[model samples]
Target: MPVWTLYGIRRGIATTSWPEKEGPTQPGVLGLPHYHADRCQDNCRACADVCLPGALSFESCEAEERLALDYGKCIGCQLCTEACPNDALTKSNDWAFGVRNRDDLIWTEALQSPPAEEVTRKIQKYFGRSLHVRHVDAGSCNGCESELQALNNPYYNLHRLGIFFTPSPRFADLLLVTGPVTYAMQGPLRETYNAMPEPRWVMAMGACAVSGGASGGGYSCGHGVEEFLPVDIYVPGCPPNPAAMIHALLLLLNRASQHVQGGQVAH
Candidate 1:
């Protein structure tokens, strides 16, 4: 027998059983910020002031002034948490964040964000049992790329779930984008999206791709992938882990139901 085959046999199955069963949890994985409005001072804007990506902002509503946290724009820098004098924003360990709608990422004190939209059977009808993804790094820092690469590794074994990453956009069913969509990559990104076969979908896989991350609002970088591309799913994190990315993809394919709401894991 081949040495590689022997090693594979010794390792057994390394794929994670998740969504259907509990799997290993990553240590030190950061998640969305938990908000406690009651803990906030009446006139405080400390957290908003320190937020690098403008994820936290004090907005004026008809009824009253409120703070809004756009999870799609958050990079999990924890600066808001650290700047909160009243503990209104705090760190959380729940890293599973994936949503179907762009509006689901925005949260205000008075308005409760609606649950993510369910993937209709139509999507499943086309690419349900199997999915082919084309990943484009517009201008990533390689953090998101590293996580994307991990999905194919033994521990994740993305292929076991019938998902695959392909080099050709012509054969892909999904466009998995990373980075903030820099000006230099805008045209190529669009061309790649255009090259994909029909019944295609796009997923913003990280804070950078979702909302430009830390580089948002820069002159050279686009705000997010959605600004140019019609994004079908949004996964938030500086670099969302493989599990979160998989959850988003599964949701897109109608193979799974959403378990994340307002950055909290419902399951």
Candidate 2:
């Protein structure tokens, strides 16, 4: 075998144990909102006033009152918590943001699995314990695929998650696609989807695939991935960080159990 092939095999073995434990923190992990009251002179509304996303807000009262922090809208940017004059705000290191309802996101909670272990075991039973992925670049700036490729790098080590990318659609269990489906790429995208065997999966990665992204309104753009293929998972973000992609993949892996069942899986 060639030196690079040997290296790849050794590296693959070294990282194959990742799915057994809690994964590493993904890039851009959302942190908690922090507040500092001492540095805040009560008149400084910079945090709440400057929030463009409206994730933070404050209501003044005659007596001492705590500033309200809405967890739902908070992207975990410490902007408000950081802008306080009295150093009244500080974010907790927690990154889990699972919620029961859109309103349930008003507060924070521990991350819940869709029963990840059970799902993994089920997939292992059906798919024979390994995953083969094939990535398709429908139409993107290459940023999403850049990070996708980085998963094979030392830090992310995606193979540890029992994931492998294949070059041929015939050997692929999952079709990991990025970018918006452009007019020119439409036929190729459909052909790729058709080429995959039964019991196949499609994961739409990035905002472009989810909704045509920045090119949604463009005359030449094909609306979205859904317009061309059935997406088993929707990983939303302009170019979602690799960790987000990993989490989304894991989520899909966990849902492979449901994939064995009938309906569509939309995320």
Candidate 3:
């Protein structure tokens, strides 16, 4: 037998059984920020004032005052946590942040008064067993791309779940996209999406792809992937960890349910 083959047999399978089993956990992984409107100061705008990406905003309503949080625009800097004088905002440990609709990422105290509705997705009917993804870098800083590469490592072995990274969009069932959509790359990104077959899906993999991350509308970059394509899944992070990415993919296929809703743990 070859030496490499013998070594491989000795090492055994290194793949993780996450989403299916209680697998490896990242240390101190911080996810979506939780908001406590009741704790918000009467007339304070501390969080909004220090928000670098303008994700936090104040609105004056006829009967009540409200604070709105667009999670897509947040880069998870946690600056808002420190900025809030009333401790209204705090760090979240929940990281499985894939959602079926984009609207789920936006939250307001006024609107959250009503109970959240259950969401249904038809992706599993078409892509339950396996999925092929075609990735495109619209205009990334490479932070998102680096985390994506880790998905294939021994620790995460994304292929174990029947998910693969395909080179050709013609054979792809999903478009895994990263970065803020740049004006120059918009045409190419659309072309890739158009090349895919029917029953296709698109995933906005990072804060940049979700809502332009720290780089909002600039001279060269557009706001986010949704501005150019219909994104079916939104995974928010400066660059989401490998586990979070896996959760998003499984959620896209309907193999798993959303755990984070309106900045609170759902499941």
| Model 3 residue 225 CA deviation in Å | 1.2
- Candidate 1 clashing pairs? none
RMSD of each predicted structure: 2.2, 8.7, 2.6
What is the Cα-based TM-score of model 2?
A: 0.57
- How well does candidate 1 match the true structure in TM-score terms? 0.91
Candidate number achieving the greatest TM-score relative to the actual structure: 1
What would the TM-score be for candidate 3 when compared with the true structure? 0.90
* lDDT score for residue 190 of model 3: 95
How do the residues 119-164 of candidate 1 rate in per-residue lDDT, one tens digit apiece? 5667878777899999999998999999999988888888888899
**Model 3 residue 251 distance off true place after TM-score fit, in angstroms:** 1.0
| lDDT per residue (tens digit) for residues 166-204 in model 3 | 999999999999989898899999999999998788999
Clashing pairs in 3: none
